[model samples]
Target chain A: NAGVTQTPKFRILKIGQSMTLQCTQDMNHNYMYWYRQDPGMGLKLIYYSVGAGITDKGEVPNGYNVSRSTTEDFPLRLELAAPSQTSVYFCASSDITWRTEAFFGQGTRLTVV
Target chain B: EDQVTQSPEALRLQEGESSSLNCSYTVSGLRGLFWYRQDPGKGPEFLFTLYSAGEEKEKERLKATLTKKESFLHITAPKPEDSATYLCAVQVESGGNQFYFGTGTSLTVIP
Candidate 1:
């Protein structure tokens, strides 16, 4: 059903470069989230959107931005890529109802040099 | 502040051996607790969701039980295919459905 899809499965960027990670869910879920996972660390929230045009900063929002233009699309932007930004990025979506589980996209492995 | 902690950073077990993974959490008000299984280079996959204390759910050889302070994911007679990193997450009552996640437990079931 293509629950959730993320683009650019892998990418390598130079310092000061910029890129956008695209995420779209066909489930029509209202809640979308962006998270980054590092080795030996838990998934840290980067940004989230409750619905279209409503976005909020998450635990690790610095150096990242998100936009929810439509219910199905929530894209994450890296303004100035740094080596610290290298990590596996995941996009997830869930229904508005409480207690519903989130479905995650495959992932985007980004490395900044 | 809400926090989640998972024990046994890594575990190794022989096929058919049963074991349990721990997930401890502290939140002002917990809306729900979730378990996910993640394979290498892939995103976390949903496994179970526990809402209240003393609740349990089972799927195949995996069973999840939740309590007031912690949760346990028990794998009974596991197989080599069951090896993966298990993650625990908690959603707080407030903050617009934000989730706090634990580092996770890496499991290796040998055949």
Candidate 2:
């Protein structure tokens, strides 16, 4: 079903630059999430949306913003990027039923220098 | 605060050896506990989901068991191809289905 897909598998950003990480899912999931995984650490939530046009901040949403314009796409935006934002970003989607597991896309590796 | 902790951080074993990875969690209300395997340069792949205590699920050489306060991912007769990082996550009943993840346990199976 192609599950979930992410764009720009790797990127390097200059300090203060801005960029967006794209995520798309064809599973018709109502829930979408963005997370960042640092080396030697667990994945931390950045932002999430329950459905289209709905978005909310997550545990570590300081430098990130997100928008869910459609049921199939949720994009994470980084404004004024900092070195602390360097990590691997993952996008996941799941059905509303809690019993279903979230499916993840191939991560995007971001480096801020 | 909701939290998930996994141990022993990393493990190395012979191909035939078997072991278990632990995930302990503390949250106001637990909706579900999940296990995933991640290879280098790739996102995590789902393995199992336990919704209640005493529930157990199995896939190939891996079995996941859940308790009131913890979950265990047991690997049986591991092979070198099983080497990867295992991650645990807990979804809370509150807070819009936010998931708390643990620092994964890196497994190395040597042939």
Candidate 3:
């Protein structure tokens, strides 16, 4: 199983540029999440979905949005990127409940100047 | 508010040194505690999951034990490849499936 996959392994954006970080999972999980990890810091959730078409905000959701129109895809969009958003972003997915381990993607390194 | 605290932010040990890392957390209706290891520039890899107080799980040289208020990751005869940041997070029983992660404990095993 391709587990979890994220695209654009690296990106550099101007202060106002917008882009989408793509994430897809083949595990048929019911839960998907997007998190950002600042250098030397732990990850903070950006958004999460319990199932396709159901999305919600997480601890840190500013400057970002997500859509889960399909069970296999959860894309995170950064609107007018800022230097503060220059961090490594990871996409993860888990099973139907909160009792299982979430699998993470390789991660996307975003740099805003 | 939910909180997670990881101790000794960073640790350096010679190969074969045995040590432990602590993770203290507070949450509403603790659902589960998860441990993951991350290498630089890489995503976290699942290590173990502890569900109840006094629960324990082991893999290779790493052992994770949990209590109501905290959890400990014990490393026995560590090797260089085992050196990486260890992260602990909790999933509140009602907090949906979102996880709040601790900053993580960086362990460096030197040869």
Top lDDT prediction, candidate number: 1
Going through the candidates in order, their DockQ values are 0.82, 0.80, 0.84
Q: Please, what are the lDDT tens digits per residue for candidate 1 over residues B18-64? A: 99999999899999999999999999999999999999999999999
- Between the candidate structures 1 and 2, which one is better when assessed by DockQ? 1
- Among these predictions, the greatest TM-score belongs to 1
Runs of candidate 3 exceeding 4 Å displacement: none
TM-score to true structure, per model = 0.99, 0.98, 0.98
lDDT of 2 by residue, A1-113 (tens): 69999998999999999999999999999999999999888999999999999999988999899999999999999999999999999999989887678899999999999
TM-score, prediction 1 = 0.99
Report lDDT (Cα) of residue A75, candidate 1.
94
Worst 10 residues of 3 chain A by lDDT: A38-47
Chain B superposition TM-score per model: 0.98, 0.98, 0.97
lDDT per residue (tens digit) for residues B7-89 in model 2: 98999999999999999999888889999999999999999999999999999999999999999999999999999999999
Which lDDT value does model 3 have at A96? Answer: 86
Off by over 4 Å in 1: none
Best by DockQ: 3
